[model samples]
Target chain A: MNTVFFLVFGLIVVVCAINVVVQRHPISSAISLIGVMGSLAIIYLQLGAEFMAAAQIIVYTGAVMVLFIFVIMLLNAGSEEGGKGPLTVRLLGVPLLLVFLGLLSYLIQRLFSDTGPVRFGDFKGGSPADVGRALFSTYLLPFEITSVLILIAILGAIVLARKELD
Target chain B: MPAAVPLSWYLVLSAVLFSLGVAGFFFRRNIITMFMSIELMLNAVNLSFVAFSFQLKQVSGNIFAFFVMVVAAAEAAVGLAIILTVFKNRATLNVDRIDSMKY
Candidate 1:
């Protein structure tokens, strides 16, 4: 059951990830990346990073992806077709990518076949409470700093994107 | 009674995703799509962190991944804003056309 779920979600992630790269329209790619994030959230759950899984869905898929789609719509970006890129990327990239991935998979399978496989219920410490405790205790400073950083980002984005007034 | 997926499988998945992100970053023509590829690379690294955290039984990796996500959000905001400014000035999103700095 665990393997089956992993296979399904992993397949979804891989397919959507490829679609994210290969799609002609930025909007289509944006939507496909959302699919990747959704499936990745499930993979995170399986790995016992419950808090990260939730964050993946909420922060990443929800806020970040929405921001991406908004930009895509606002810009009125269209599908690109061989838009004067280097000849290598325009011609050889796709096939080379496939072969490179095949080699990588083969290498990884060869290297780590002895370790124990991932099993659910093996990890129990990924609860929200545990993450909160760590966040407030050991990582308190970085957490606070991140909030300030987010504030700065918001201000900068607003400043840069606002219209010029005469 | 399904078999457990090996730890290497997850790591391998991360590797593949990262490579795909790199491919997109190199191949795409639009700036937004390239930015999405950067996001993909970040996500792949986050996955690697979480997988290692599971392997080592430490929460530190998860914390790092969380930080990466936060930084990525900031990057996306500033980046998209810059893209908007560029579009307003130049009226084009194709990366090849925005080479005013290439003097």
Candidate 2:
């Protein structure tokens, strides 16, 4: 059951992630990324990270993706113009990417061979209560700092997007 | 009972996604697509964090993932604004064409 769930959602994530990169129009890419996020949320649920799963949907799919779409619409961005980059990159990009992926997978599998399999329900420490406790205690300082960071981001965005003064 | 998935599978998936993100970042000509690729990379890392959290039976990894989400949110906000500013000034979103600073 767990394996099936993981396989299905994992496939969705991989497919949608590819779509995100392959789609020419920014809106299509944004929608594909939303699909990727939604499936990843399910994978997070399978991993027993319930809070993280919910947050993934609410924050990423809901907020971040919406923002991306809005920006695409606001900019009226069109499909990517067809310009095959430098000859070396155009010819070797896909092959090099495949090699990089193969190497990374090989390294990860070898290094973590003994880490054991993940069984759903084996770990219940991902509940909101547990996460909240840790956030307020051990991670309290970082938590506060992120709020300030968000404030700065908000100010910077507003200032950047605002109309230029005469 | 169903068979368990090895932890490495999740890690491998994360790696594949990250690599794809890198590919998109380098190959895509549109600035928004490139920015979305960066977000894809961040999401890939978050998956790895959650997987490790499950492996170690600790909430710290989840906490870390949470912080990553916070940072990603802030980054998207500022990044889109910058993209907007770039579009306003340059009137284009193609990364190849917006090379005023490239020497």
Q: Estimate each model's TM-score.
A: 0.93, 0.98
lDDT of 2 by residue, A1-166 (tens): 7788889998999999999988998999999999999999999988889999999999999999999999999888989899878899989999999999999999998899998878889899999999999999999999999999999999999999999889
> Which pairs, if any, clash in model 2?
none
Candidate 1 lDDT, B23-99, residue by residue in tens: 99988888999999999999999998988888777888888899999999999999999999999999988888899
Docking class of 1: medium
CAPRI quality band, candidate 2: high
Off by over 4 Å in 2: none
DockQ values per model: 0.69, 0.81
Q: Cα miss at A22, model 2 (Å)? A: 1.0
Q: How far out, in Å, is residue A19 in model 1?
A: 0.7
User: Least accurate stretch of 10 residues (summed lDDT) in model 1 chain B?
Assistant: B1-10
Question: How far off is each candidate at the interface, as Cα RMSD in Å?
Answer: 1.8, 1.3
